[model samples]
Target: MSSQCPDADNANATPATEQWTSISKHVVNSYLEANNALLAAMGFSSTAEDAPTTESAVDTTTPSPTAEIAFGDENWVMERSTDDYDTLGVGDYVRFSKPIADTDVSAFARVSGDTNRLHLESDFAEDTQFGGQIAHGTLVAGTISAALARLPGVTVYLSQDLEFTGPVRIGETVTAECEIVEELGGDRYRLHTTVIGGDDETVIDGEAVVIINELPGK
Candidate 1:
C-alpha cells in the first residue's frame, strides 16, 4: 500500500479554493456593475465600489489631515462672515448655495425614505397644486444645516424650528443663510436661518440653536 502525504493534499485544496473565490468575486462585481448602471439611468448615482463586499474590512486607522477647511465642491457656493473661530459671535453668518438637481432629489429620497410622489413623479405632481415636481421640504431645509457647517468651528445643532413658506422646484438654485443673532452662554448661539429661492422668495424660514466647538488640535 502507498502512504498519502497530508502536505500534498492541503496544497492541492488551496489552489481550488482560491480559484473559486476569484470566480465568485468576478460574478459579484459584474452584477454590481449592472445594478449601478440601472440606478444611474433612474437618476440615482451609484457605483460598483459602493456595494459592500464580504471580504472587506472596516478601516480603523486615524485619518490624514488636509490643507484647507473641508467644504462642498466647486458647484456649491459658500460665503462666511468670519474666518477666525475664536471671534465667532453675534452677527457672524454663513451662506451656502447650490442648485437642486434631479439626482439630488433621487438620492435624498433614497437616504431619507421620503418618496412622496410630489417630489418624485412629475406626472402625479403635475396633477396636484404644485403643477410639477418639487423638492422635498426637508431636503430644502437641509441647506440650513449645510450653511451651519461652514461656520468657523465645529457646529453642533441643539434645536431647530422651521416653517416651510414656499416650495422649491427641481433645478432651482437656493441659498441658505444662517446668521448668529444671540450669543447664549457656554459657546452656544441662536441663529436666524432662512433658505431663499429665485426671485428672492423664502422657501424655508427657521431658527436654530447650536454650540460651536474648537477644532481638534487647534
Candidate 2:
C-alpha cells in the first residue's frame, strides 16, 4: 500500500508540475513580447522569435536607407530653417513634433525608473490636480533634444535649463522649437528651446548651449 501510494502521488505531481511550468513559460513569454514591442517602438530590434507583432519593428536583416538627418519617424513632423551644416548660424531653427503616445509613457517609465502613478495609472491620475495622466516633464523636455538633433550638424549638448510651466497630457502632440539665439564661437551656440503642447500651451521653456560639430565625413 505504501509503494502504491508513492506511485500515485508521483503521477499526480508530474502533471501538476508540468502544468505549472507551462503557465510560467506563458507568463514569461508574454512579458518578453511586451518588452520587445516597446523596444521596437524606441528604435530597437528584438531577435526573439516569439516577440509580439508591432508595426514599428525594423527588420534587422535589411540595411536601413540613408537619410539627410538620422532622426524621427514618419509620424514625426520636422521643420528646419536650413540644412547647410556649415551655414548654421543665428536664426537657424528646427521644430520637431510628435505625439506622446501611451507606449512612450510606459517605455519611459520602464527605462527611466520613474514609475510615477500620475504618469502611469489613469485611474490614480484622474484624482490628481491635473485630473488625468500626464507625460513625464523630462520626457516632454526630451523633445527639445530631438529637435536639436535635427539641426544641420552633429549637435552636442553643453548645458540646458528647463522650466515646466504646464503639463503635457498623454497622447498630446508637442513640438519642440530650438532656435539659435547667439553664437558663442568655437562651434558653440546658445539656443532658445521651447516645447508647445497640443493646445498651443508652452509646456516647457528652456535654453540650451550646444556645440555643433560637422557630421563625420562631411
**Best model per TM-score:** 2
Q: Mark the 10 consecutive residues where model 2 has the least summed lDDT.
A: 1-10
lDDT value for model 2 = 0.79
Best by the lDDT measure: 2
Candidate 2, residue 145: how far the Cα is off, in Å: 0.5
Task: Give the TM-score (vs. native) of candidate 2.
Answer: 0.71
Model 2 per-residue lDDT tens digits across residues 1-218? 00122123332233435533554564566568777666655555677575547867544554344442243457899999999998899999999999998767766665666656677656656767999889999999999999998898899999999989999998899999999999999999999999999999898998999999998886
Pairs that clash in candidate 1: none
Deviation in angstroms for 15 in model 1?
A: 48
- For candidate 2, the C-alpha RMSD (Å) to the true structure equals 13.8
lDDT of each: 0.78, 0.79
Model 1, span 49-75: residue lDDT tens: 755456564434443344332434567
Each candidate's clash count: 0, 0
Q: What is the lDDT of residue 213 in candidate 1?
A: 94
